[model samples]
Structures are given as structure tokens and as C-alpha cells.
Target: MPREVRELAEDPTGVDAGTQDAVLLFVGGPLDGRVEIREARHGEPLPTVTHVHLHGGPKVVHRYDLTPLGPGVGVYHLRPQQVVRDRSVAD
Candidate 1:
């Protein structure tokens, strides 16, 4: 799984910088403490085009993801979100 993430995070040119929602299978890792694979409210994996799981946040300042592209492999990059809200802008 580490190899998969390496490939994904390697070529920034291969992935869009704004796509924060990358799919990754958490086999095991040191950074596992920071990433939770289940939805915060549902406690279930999200059903998306690829990932069986996704990270959630009440407020996310930054994120990086490895969207699966093949068996044990994925396309990786940073994703964007409205981490900070402007009082002037309406939700």
C-alpha cells in the first residue's frame, strides 16, 4: 500500500492539485493516526467512484489523497475545501 501511495504522490503533474479526495487503502502506516477512513457521522465507508472509504472533517485545513487507479495503486494529490469561512459569504 505504501508503494501505491508513493506512485500517487510522486508525479504532481499526473494529478490535479485541487482534488483532495484521493482513495487509499490503509494497510498500516505511521501517519495512520491522522487519517480516519470512516465517515464522521455515519461510521461507514463512503461509496464513491473508487474509494470504499474517505476522510471526514468538521473543519479541514489541508488534505492529501491517493485515488485508486489500479490494483493496489492510486493517483495522488492535495484536495481543496472551504476550511476557512468568510462571514461575508453565505453558505
Candidate 2:
């Protein structure tokens, strides 16, 4: 997890400059306490799923879904979504 997210999660008001856009805070799974800055547009909905790909060893992907926390802020929790594996690679 990124340190900035931990800081922001602790104090949302302490968001740094140039990140005035809507904030997406991740909770649970590998992305727990991670933060993502998204451009907020009127009538446009935020992403429902967040994808994290691991390429260090066996290729894998984790998915998380958004759970609204409040206006301009949301917590994306790790869902029961199946982990995607790169079948192209040999075990």
C-alpha cells in the first residue's frame, strides 16, 4: 500500500496539492490503504472495479469494487471476484 493513502485515510483533509480531484481510497486485499485520484465530472459515474496486476512471479490479477463512503470519497473493498491467472505461463 502507498504511504500517501495511509496518510490520507488518517486525515482526508490533508490531501496534497494538484490532487483536488475526487479521491478513491482502497481497503482490503493488496490495495488496502491505497489512494487513487480521479477526475470528477458531472453525471459521470466512478469506476466500480479496480484491477491490480502482479507480474513479479506468477501473473495474477486482483479486483476490487467501490463502496461509497461519502460525497467525493469512496472505499473500494476487495470483492470475492476470482483471481485471474495468466494461463499462457507454465506452472
Candidate 3:
């Protein structure tokens, strides 16, 4: 995954230099099922995308949508979000 992200970093897609929303995913789990994304309202939990489940464990890709709060922002749905960087392209 890190190698893939490294290639994405050099993407010529004109990614800006700021924050971006990226989806993280775990390799295996109940989370492997379909997931949804909801909007975060006032005083509410931020929007999140459930990626996968760790077999009999908790949701692995349980995290909020990293909506870019600034420029250079990009989004990539990565099976391993922790490894994939913002504005990175797929290898």
C-alpha cells in the first residue's frame, strides 16, 4: 500500500497542496460489506465511511470523511487508508 501511495504522490493530476477527504479500509472483516457516507451536522459526529470489519472484531475502517478544509485537497478510497496519503493516485 505504501508503494502504491508513493506512486500516487507523483501523480500529475494537478492535486493541490492542502487537505483532502480520503476513505480508509481494512483488509478483511464484516466491514467488507457495503458502506455509506452521511453528512455531519451541527453538534453531530463527523461523517464517516465504514471500510471493513476485523472478522469478529470491531469495524476496522471506522473513520470520518476527511473533507478537505483547505486547498490541494484530494480523496482516494484506499483499502489501507493509514498508508495512503492525501491527493495520492492509485498505482
Candidate 4:
């Protein structure tokens, strides 16, 4: 199931001053169960894409798209965007 979060981050413009911080939840793929606090205004839209970079052997990039649960609440589900390989690493 997707987790619900409220817009708690303070607006830099002082329009939506919040006490807590807003969060984006990730479900599935390498970022499952990850919660990220993001700065957002009261009426502004949230981010739609999340990028994750992995380094060790060959560099890999993972992309996740936001799936809105409700206002200020959404889940980032892993999408088959692409897997980038380092140029130094042979295919």
C-alpha cells in the first residue's frame, strides 16, 4: 500500500509556513520504503520524477515516477526508464 503524507514544509515565500516537513515515499525497486523530505509550496505541484545513482561496479541510474495518493501525498513507483552503464565498463 502507498503511504499518505501532508504538505508540512515551510514555503520560502512565507505563503505556506508549515511546522513539519513534507515527504515523498518510494515503493518498489531499489528505493522501496524510502522517505524523502522535500520543500514545497501550498499550491505548487510536487516533483514527478526521482533519480537514483548506484556506484560500485558499473554505474547505474534508476528512475521513479510519482503516483499521487491524494493531496500532498504520493508514492514513487519504479518505472522501466533505463539503466545506464558506465562507458568504462564493457557491455
lDDT of each: 0.40, 0.67, 0.38, 0.64
> Residue 21 of candidate 3: its Cα lDDT?
31
Candidate 4's C-alpha runs over 4 A off are 1-21, 41-47, 81-91
Model 4 clashing residue pairs (backbone): none
Q: Rank the models by TM-score, top first.
A: 2, 4, 1, 3
Estimated TM-score for each candidate:
0.25, 0.53, 0.22, 0.52
What is the TM-score of candidate 1? 0.25
TM-score result, candidate 2:
0.53
Q: Write the per-residue lDDT of candidate 1 for residues 1-91, one digit (tens) a residue.
A: 3554444555456654333333345322323434443333443233322222435844323344555554323433444443456789887
Q: In candidate 4, what are the lDDT values of residues 1-91, reduced to their tens digit? A: 9999757555444443343345679877778899876666443335566565657775556667777665456778778766455799777
Which candidate has the highest lDDT of all? 2
Model 3 pairs whose backbones collide: 8-89, 16-72, 17-72, 18-72, 21-66, 29-53, 31-52, 31-53
Error of 2 at 68 (Å): 1.2
Q: Write the per-residue lDDT of candidate 2 for residues 1-91, one digit (tens) a residue.
A: 6565443354467754334466788877788888976775443335566565767686556667777666567778787766567899999
Model 3 lDDT per residue over 1-91, tens place: 3554444565465553323233222223344333333222222223444544566764456443434333332232333346546567765
Total backbone collisions for each predicted model: 2, 0, 8, 0
